[model samples]
Target: MQTVSFLFFNIILPIFIPIIAGYLLQRKFPLNVATLTKIQFYIFIPALLFTTIYQTELNSALLRDLILANLVLFVLLWAVCLICARLMKLDAGKRSAFINSVCFYNSGNYCIPLIQLMYHTPFAFSIQIIVMLIQQLLTNTVGVMNTSSANRSWKGALLENFRMPMTYAVLIALLCRWLSIDVPKPLWTSFELMAQGLVPTALITLGAQLASTHLYLRNFRVLVSNAMRLLVGPLLAAAVCWMWGISGVVAQVMVICAAAPSAVNTVLLAIEYRSDPEFASQTVFLSTLLSALTMPVVIALVQYL
Candidate 1:
């Protein structure tokens, strides 16, 4: 009981306060979520990723394990979504949206801050950055291809990933690390400042997005997607951690990250590709709302397991 309370008050409450503010603020003034999203994608997120990766002491073993753990979990989620889609007899667009809603999670804005709050170590933060990168890569490449194949070339979807600022952020960080290229003090300071604002800005953006999202509580399909994202995800992640011998903070971060809600980007892609945007948005909103109840439990469980 104490553990659960601590998780809620210390961790969960801090995260949601800004989210609720964003939701209410948006409800009143109606901020442009797209502009906020671009700020996150172009400026804040890359800054956070670059600075964290450059500063963290990443080892080959840790990197390899993080990559492998994410991949295994991702593949498992993908397969499960595919089977579910088939069983549900969804059409092409809905199937694509369903797969994306189930497979891709909100690793960036959500999990990064959550990890930061849970563990104050650079190691845990680095693990989450890598996880976020893997998720973004897969979401942009495979997810885009899946959703846009009917109207665009897969090559275009593949190319779209390269255009993202995050792609370059990882490359530049790794390159600087490899070459021992030290960034100028002023530039680095700027990067740190931007990175520091990521948590509040991101949560606020998410809240605003939710405020604008049209909820569909009665949709059985949305519930199915929510079940996969919020419930099955942590279970699969726990299994994957056990399989990989991931223990301690690594295991905890991975499982908690797995329990995060669906990606907001999934809805953007669904809308862009003329897929089932309604379902995509509904899943994101519902899953995020449900995760408020589910995440503290998952956080506590990971601590014990």
Candidate 2:
């Protein structure tokens, strides 16, 4: 019971309150969610990534686990997306949104806070960071391709991937690790301060985006598609973790991260690729709203199992 309450107050409430509040404010003020999203994407997220990786102690085992966990989740999600696409008989644009809805989870923005609240360990936070990095890369590259038009070249996608701030940060971290270099204290402090802005700003921005979205509750197809994203997607992820013999805090992190709703990135990609951005945005907003219930339940179930 205490765990449940803790999860709510520490993990769930902190996330959802901002979303709800932002949505309400947006209804009144109608802020430009796109601008906020751009700020997060370009500045805040990169700062978070560089600082987290630069200061952390890295080793081969951790890297291997993080990579393997991401790979397993990605493959499972890809399979789910393909199957869902065929079953729904979706057109190309809708299919892209559907695929992305299933494939992309809100790992970086949403999961980071929850992991920190629950585990309260730098190592645990580091693992989540690594997992998110992998997720970010995959979502930008393969995820973009899956949702994009055929005319979209792999080269263009690769270039976009290379341009990601988090990618550069990871590269630097890797180099530092390889060279046994210590990150200077002043730089670390700066990174830390910048990184601190990531979670709240991200959550608020997500809320603002949700507020900006049109909630089509009557759109049963969209609802069902989102259900698959929020419900079935996490179940599939849990099964993969079990099969991989992932247990303890690591397993919990994987399950929780997997349980996050479709990323806002999906909506951005949908807009960029000329997919059904409305459907994509609506699905992401609704799934995130519903995840307040779903995530805690998923976590509880995993704990028992």
Number of clashes in every candidate structure? 0, 0
Lowest lDDT sum, 10 consecutive residues, model 2, at 1-10
Which ranges in model 1 have alpha carbons more than 4 Å from their true place?
Answer: none
Residue 281 of candidate 1: its Cα lDDT?
A: 95
Cα deviation in Å at residue 164, candidate 1?
1.7
Cα lDDT of model 1 by residue, 69-100, tens digit: 89999999999999999999999889999999
Candidate 2 differs from the real structure by a C-alpha RMSD in angstroms, to one decimal, of 2.2
lDDT of 1 at 174: 88
Against the true structure, what is each candidate's TM-score? 0.95, 0.90
Q: Which stretches of candidate 2 lie over 4 Å from their true place?
A: 1-6
